[model samples]
Target: MTTSPTTTTLDAVLAGLMRRYSERVPDVQKVLDVMLDAGVIQSPDEIENDHIAFRTMGVPNLGLGSFEKIFLHLGYERRDEYNFVEKKLSAYWYSPPRPDLPRIFASELRVNELSADAQRIIHRYTDTVTSDPVDSLDLDDANAVDQFLHQPLWKTPTLADYQTLLNESEYAAWVIYNRYYLNHFTISVHNLKPGYNTIDEFVAFLQARGLRLNSAGGIIKVSPDGDLRQASTVAQMIDAEFADGAIFRIAGSYVEFAERRVLSPFQDLPADQITRQHRREGFETSNADKIFESTFTTQTGK
Candidate 1:
């Protein structure tokens, strides 16, 4: 817990992950180091133990899958998603044992956005509902929340209970955060809603303006609300011209699925900021992008 800057390889390794000097990265990296010392073999185990999958020693808010991708970069290949199912979720390995299973910052963030559909449902029906309690609703992503709210999600709570949960619970935090996530469309404003007209108009807007859909990889709806929101999957981005999350004016324009505000692969440190390398460093996979690509290549059945 007390990692002194002097005489600590763990500290040096962690410093590399936090090269950008991110506060979130350090706390999460610290968590990962503890887990490593405790003999956590796979990233998911670390997540199960402490509700985090840090790319570095101290950051927990980044996606667990991102760190897994880092493992692939090192060639510490594990079973596929099917293996996760086949082994009851125990198959895992790491590549380049130094950085082990962590990173200093977040990843490319276009695909991971909150869906408008989720916002429409959770916020729209928050009041006047008695059976499904808003607090009990799964609120990590808009799509999942949408799915959960479709039926009597909360065993029939009273309106008061719904309000209480909405006021003081993780569900509320999720919805409020999603509202923030959905607001980040730096592109042209074609529509403010997700209806037939809005979706169509937005699609036209992206095309007419010649805007690209972040990376080729589109979307992954964590909730039912995300059923409509999509971009390209990592593989789709690599192999196909269009993606599952979007029809490119074919089916529909991409909508947010993963939370957007998080850091992503498409982004990089700003131009003017000096890295000011730490006296020490966090051992990381220099070729993380290559590893990222491999995960998609191997998984897409290509």
Candidate 2:
């Protein structure tokens, strides 16, 4: 099959995100290493990436409106919207142009819904972005898009501002410091070899390997219908430099594992005949709510 220009560009953009994400989040390589040692896969590429996520601050000329444009231009279709009321977050999942590509789960903080002082702390940094940065990008240029995704959208935030936001919304503090960096890339566990193919088995493998699992709701988050099961590693901490070069160790990024069980109608199909379409689709709000805390001090402080 011939890959279109849009798909090629999308490939490069995803590659850039994963490369840097793996470098910053040690758990990425750690997970891959354990999988390799356990014969779960022959190489890292053999793993199916279910999806990748990004965090953003909801403010003028930014947030989902601006961020979604990049992927939408690459042929990704916007799926469902999810609201995290308590966290003051709104997110949407985007289906990939090709099944081989990972889906996108992007969320933005509801800056306006935050406390007056918290909003002030966020706007102080985000206000610098007077225009939607994506509007300036030539989406066809893979290199430019890759660079834009990694470049700073605003000035480096001060430790004080970050701390204040953290007290209000950890999501806000994350966006202020992390910007558009990939929050996480999930591994599709359903397709793995037998013993490692289910979320329970996979979580057990990871726990045995000494990897810390996020226990916000439980080590494994199951949807109400029980078709989608998910789990994540507690976000690894990074020594981050704040404005004026004050260094502090804070939550970075984490790896997630998902198992999309075959829908009831497709349960009788032969294993080999089952594809992504035969399984449960989309994300669960309740499962995602706790998954968001993978980076919170509540989890990272553990």
Candidate 3:
């Protein structure tokens, strides 16, 4: 199919996201290459991304508000809110202007909910971002969006501070080291061919190919309605250098697969009545809560 101008722009934006992410997590590129080699996808265009997620520290002049402006300018609208009290996170998903574009899942670490020491450590770096970085970007420009995705909003932290944040909240540590990084990109399993149309089947495919799956909350987390099934690969660890000049292996980004069921009204209806009704929209908090562990040391390992 010929790509539209809008689609072309969106592809460029997504490509930029992948480029920034792949630089830190080479496993993502490997996964995409393997998918192509195995004939799972004819090309990158055939792989429909269900959504892309980002992690940020919860603080003034930062967090979702600052990060979302770029997408918002591109006509994406906020759709749902999710709170993970246990993880001290507050997230929201954004719907794209067009159906062809992927959804956005951005989460922020609730800094105030952490210990004083941890909060201090987090602030030490976030404070360096004197102003909202997104404000300085030309949101309407695709190239600007790409630059903003890779722009570091804060100074690098010392190994000690990173360890302190890690001890308290792994999410905080991840943001501290990997600022504005794409946390994960989810594949719309239903869009794939029959052999890989379900989360269970896709998870098996990844495992058979030697990709480690996050076993927390099981390999697949299902929604209460059983309509949404999700799973993610345990993040790949990579060497990271701290401000103090020390290098350590840290958890990086991962790939996620999702299979959404049809809506109840469309399930028993005739084919005519069910036109455009096969996919379940929005996200599940329980499923996302576990998916967030993709970048944690416990899930990714040392």
Candidate 4:
């Protein structure tokens, strides 16, 4: 089948993101391989990405404001905002101009909310990357987006600083280490075949294949209305070297699976009609809050 122009452009963008994501988190490639080999997904194109998420530090000229410019230039419009006070995170979801493209979910840590000591430690590194790195790129260029996703904006942290941040917030430690790397890419399980249609079934499939999951909110976080269900693999740990020449295993990126239900208005309609209707879109604060735990040391066993 001849691919549409939009599909062609989206394919290039997704490929670029995946290439950078897989470089640091090799498990992502492994997971995709397993799904394909198991016949869970006929091909890479068959597995639709519901969205791609990024975690950033909420400092001057950083975080969502800076990170989002690239996507905005690519035709994404910002949507709802969510606050996770406990996690010290504020996130927003961006809708793609085209329905076939995946949504964008970017979250930033509210650094000011951290203790004075933690904030100082974070600033020591973030201050090094003075300007918004994304500003230097031409968002209209696909290669620019690809390079921006993988570029390290800040210098590496020392073991002391890393431990300090980890003691207060794992999220901060993660950002300091993996600067601007794609945090996670979610697979839209709703698009999969019958046996793997639901989050439960898909989770079971992965479990059976020996992949560990983040059980923060019972492995599957569902919205109060039961329309959105989500789960994620516990982040895999990899050796990370600190400035002091000591290597420690730290939490890396993970993969997520999402299944969104049709809206209540279309729930009672015929299957075909429901499929044609607009499905419930956007992120759930509570569900996403738990999904963020996928990178915690407790969940990842780092």
The lDDT values for all models are 0.26, 0.93, 0.84, 0.85
Clashing residue pair totals per candidate (backbone < 3 A): 42, 0, 0, 0
State which candidate has the highest lDDT: 2
Name the better of 2 and 4 by TM-score. Answer: 2
Mind giving the per-residue lDDT tens digits that candidate 2 earns over 121-189?
778888888888899899999999999999999999999888888888888888899999999999999
RMSD of each: 21.6, 0.7, 2.6, 2.5
Instruction: Return whichever of 1 and 3 wins on lDDT.
Output: 3
For model 4, what is the error of residue 32's alpha carbon versus the real structure, in angstroms, after optimal superposition?
2.7
In candidate 2, residue 295 scores what lDDT? 96
- Compute each candidate's TM-score over C-alphas: 0.18, 0.99, 0.92, 0.92
Best by TM-score: 2
Candidate 2 Cα deviation (angstroms), residue 70: 0.2
lDDT of 4 by residue, 159-229 (tens): 88999999999999999998877789988888888898889899898898888899998899999989899
Query: Which 10 consecutive residues of model 3 have the lowest summed lDDT?
Result: 270-279
- What tens digits encode model 3's per-residue C-alpha lDDT throughout 57-162? 8898999888888777767899989999999999999998777778899999999999999988888878878888889876657787788788778888899998
Clashing pairs in 4: none
Residue 134's lDDT in candidate 1: 34
Instruction: Quote the lDDT for 138 in model 4.
Output: 64
Per-residue lDDT of 98 in model 1: 30
lDDT of 1: 0.26
